[model samples]
Target chain A: MAGGFAESGADLELVGISKRFPGFTAIEELDLTIPAGSFFALLGPSGCGKTTTLRLIAGLEEPTTGRIYLGGKDVTDTKTYRRPVNTVFQSYALFPHMSVIDNVAFGLRRRGIREARALAHEALKLVELDHVAARRPAQLSGGQQQRVALARAVVNRPALLLLDEPLGALDLKLRRQMQIELKVIQGDVGLTFLHVTHDQEEAMTMADTVAVMNKGRIEQMGAPEELYELPKTVFVANFLGQSNLFTGPVVSSGKDSIVVDIGGRKLEVPRERAQRHAGEVTIGVRPEKLQLHGAEPKAAAGTNVLGPGRVTDVSFSGVSTQYQIAIPGLGTVSLFAQNRDVGAVLREGAEVWVSWDVAHGFGVADDPADGPRFDPDDDTRSIAVQRREKLEAELEGA
Target chain B: MAFGAFGGSPATTPASDAAPRRGGLIALFLLLPGAAYLSLFFLVPLVSLILTSFQAVDPNAFEIGKFVYAFQWQNYVDVVTTYWPHILRSFGYAALATVLALLFSYPLAYVIGVKLRRFPLLQALALTLVIAPFFISFLLRTLAWKQIFSDEGVVVTALQALSLLGPADHLTGTPFSVIFGLTYNFIPFMTLPIYTSLERLDLRYVEAGGDLYASPASTFLRVTLPLSLPGVVSGTLLTFIPASGDYINASRDFLGSTDTAMIGNVIEANFLQLQNYPAAAALSIVLMAVILVLVGAYVRRSGTEDLL
Candidate 1:
């Protein structure tokens, strides 16, 4: 693993952290270490425990049984006010009554620090909101309010910063811009940021290290590229981005490679990615990893897997062209390609050859009843929220 | 602007620049009826009262009790000298009752709105209890309190048993009992508005305050209290204005003695017993003017002009 402040010691630690509400366990048996000064993200879909994990670190919620350490001190039993941590809430939560400067300097004034206004001015300047310091939060635009929230948290200079979907309220364009700005500010300030987000793209763009959480446990933790390319579970593979999976019994296992036959066609996968499976496995490749050609291509040196297919769906998504291809024997597969130099747009029913390198194929333990990827955007506290919503809809339907 | 705040889509968009203008026009139209009512009842009475305050009482020139409005401006000066103690006492009692009601209701509202929120049933029950006072007649409720604080009632008997009060001392008709009656009767007024604001308060700001290293007290004072000020302002106005002009609660027949008479009691006596309409009108005008000025100053100081 790469080393830096992460090796210096964990800035925040949670050991055996679990939180149980009256009806259900929100988070269970979770242990995580956010390296000092690293931009880390807890990424998952709406019902995942990523947000719960962030709340535990911010001292907003106490664990049912666990210890929380901040900068090498055990703060498990400490009050939230005494903990050296701060959070930028999803709603911004700026004091609607106070001016922007008062909102930003609130922590310092509580700490009894002299020259709080000066410090607040500096923090606002960092977010480029100093000019509007005298205005109330209600008077500011959404994006500006979000910046004030960011400034308010950073001004405290806490040992660790927790951001709970801090950019969730902004428009898509503003969210994209703030993602860049957040990364820059995290870099400049060098504060350990534990960002919780459901947006995979937001996680990938801003965090140096990403931990994809599901239910209440960490599914995978690594660099964004590693999690995207070498996902260990079907949930992680599909949740990070779209994936094409080939489920079949493993025919051969190798030190350098593994051979799996799919629909009477043999495809080779690199052995390094196949170590997690034994019997039945699914070899997965990302949609963008597959290359398409008009004619059937011969197996090349690096591209050991190749197949002929017919396009079932051709979707033009501005930046990339998405095509759903149906192999003769295989069910269906998805391929994404840059639209830059396309000679002609591929229409539905067009025949094509799809190929990818052995390195792109990774294995995951195949589950019998694997469903389609769940990517709902309306995030709340619990996984059962969706189920309850579905039940309510059904009751209304009748 | 109602739809604009929610951000209208291009498909269903109204005229952008004209939205707030149209909204304001509709608001004006909606306000016209209430404005007309206030002008007819409140504005007309107030103007008549101001004119009547300057009238002279010529007892025999008219009937035994009637008089022309002789524009005697000295009526105000004569009433101020005559009833200055009653005016001061009215304000003092109102101010004390307002402060007491605030202290009592804030914690109640906070607990109901924030602490008990997760228990919807309990929050609903608590809120109903707060508003339950309105179900009973106000006069009956004050009478109930008068009974509770009577010389031989449980409260005074307990105080005597505890040696906290002398056997001869009684709470039936004192300044304390009058203030207590005002506070008890108007508590719901102070609580519900504060509860409305507190109910909608985002707990995230409290969490944010804690995250910023503020103690619980600090968070309450700086965040919770300031955020709930709009409610506090409205609640105090609702409680104080009516309490100052309340004759029934402080009348000798109720919980108060003649010594504890407020301005409202004096006006009642002048209008009913003495049949002195000019003096009552002058006192009523002064009371209204005082309340308006005080409430105006208060709302301005609280920085809750949006509420007013």
Candidate 2:
């Protein structure tokens, strides 16, 4: 790699950042530190302030109250052009009037760097788009334009690279391909990348650290596996992936585990996995971690079991069969079973028990605001119908 | 009765054939009014003017308006030679006015379109003020300016007080007053198009420029200006084409004197006072041809022909 293409990365720090517009706050008092040469992802739904954070770091937006430090140097008041940062905007924002090569060379030329085009060519080659260097951005496909945008920012060799939902416009297949390419390129260049996206899968597949943002706050931040295996908050648990949650009071606290009374049944949660062990607590287990049995098997030690409930729905995807079991007092729980035993596909209305290892059950403080209300009407509607209605309501509210 | 009616119809008639034929008939019918209006008002007059340009004055006629139908091609040559200075002066003044208007309107448009975008009410008010002048008559506006620059008017007196103009130097009926009137009257024309283009400009491109390490001025030079060239081209065309052939600002009754008489004034004088139909017609044709060539070259040079 060329020396100009692989400048050592600088760490970014945002201290007490708060951004407020006319009526609403975009980002509340938030502090985050991104280590040098780390591929970090800020994962959040829309309106969660992840993009705002990225903009603040890029100097496109100034925090209402905060200091921004890059490599331990305070740059809070620096102009966007003076900051050693570049961003791949969500829309690509490629200059339509300029050719692709010119677009990539723009930052280099602005910095008065010699051999700007040669450097731009090398950057384009890194993205595997050197062949289309002479074409305009409008002439390229969405995936091609995305790479061009990446190359344009990467060529600058800035201390930090901010990607704001950069692959949001690509198709699913193309997005998957670009995710891998982006990781490879990030490794090759070794620049600190702050990727802001709403797609949890994209974040988990690429980022070294994923921060789940909700309502202008970072609910949880950790490695992808750590976050998935054990989320710290209800928002993080629900937003990252599907989590089957059972909320109840902690009936007993022991040295190594805490027993929670969930709807007449008692479940044991590991003490280390539980964020809180007193008052009302919500224990969660991932769908894939839970195993479904046709009948009550022999009680295994270190196992938490639920549901001598009837199966309400069974959906057979290519690789896995997802089953929804409706317990009498508790609501329906989702379970994903890998297609290892094809002949053992359980039918709807079958009485089944869902069980998981006690270590797999994680606990978080019960969030009453987002807790599922058990509606008598919910039993009549299928899970898919309920999901669609919830989606419609959310859309209307948005 | 329904069965008999259906059975009597031709079963082999292709439904697609009748539909397209009917569609074609409807399209032709829809195009009739506009085509007829153009032919009657525009095409007929144009052909007549072209024919008149080649006619000769009849010496044997008793009336002043009488003309002889002949291929008198020398009429074009005669008008060019006799009024070449007036033609040159028209173009020069129009070009100056267009440049001046652009210089003034670009910043105004940018302020209204880009800067005030956050304050939409203010932007709308600014745009309304730009367009509000159209409610008044164009002639009245020029006359208003003529009054403002009169010898005894406030502007001339102020300039005299500042010693910028000599005591005897008047503002009215000079080249300055005439060109100024053209620019002022057509400023809205120049501003509205440029404003529209600037308003539609996606600001992310500008932000990208800043992110790419270009300073504010450099970003404008490298991005904003080039992207808004389409608007500039159209704005200049809108101001230049009419300003070049406009007689009101150059007429003796308005801002001009004999020294500042343009091709439009000459054409008006030839047609109305001198009754020289051929010369007037020839001048009009020449002006149209020149404006067409100028605008074409400009659009081509700006590389915004695709936009047109």
Calculate each model's fnat, 2 decimals: 0.97, 0.90
In model 1, what lDDT does residue B70 have? Answer: 82
lDDT tens digits by residue: candidate 2, A231-299? 877777777777888889999999999999999999999999998989998888988999898889678
Residue A102 lDDT (model 1): 95
- lDDT value, candidate 2, whole model: 0.90
Task: Report lDDT per candidate.
Answer: 0.85, 0.90
Q: After superposition, how far is residue A310 of candidate 1 from its true place, in Å?
A: 1.2
For model 2, how does the per-residue alpha-carbon lDDT over B1-308 read when each residue is reduced to its tens digit?
77776674677455875878887898999999999999999999999999999998798988898898789999999999999999999999999999999999999999999999999999999999999999999899889988999998999999999999999998888999999999999899999999999999999999999999899999999999999988999899999999999999988899999999999999999999999899999999999999999988888888977544
Model 1: per-residue Cα lDDT over A1-398, one tens digit each = 10111222247888899999888888889888887989999998776777878887877888998898888889888888887777899998898878999999988888888889999999999999999999999999999999999999888777788899999889889999999999999888888899999988899989999998888888889999898889888888878887888877778877788788787777788888874545677888988899898987876765745567889877665578778899887878888888887533788998888889888888875452474665545322123356667989999989
Provide the TM-score of chain B versus the true chain B for each model in turn.
0.89, 0.90
What's the CA RMSD for each of the models?
6.2, 5.9
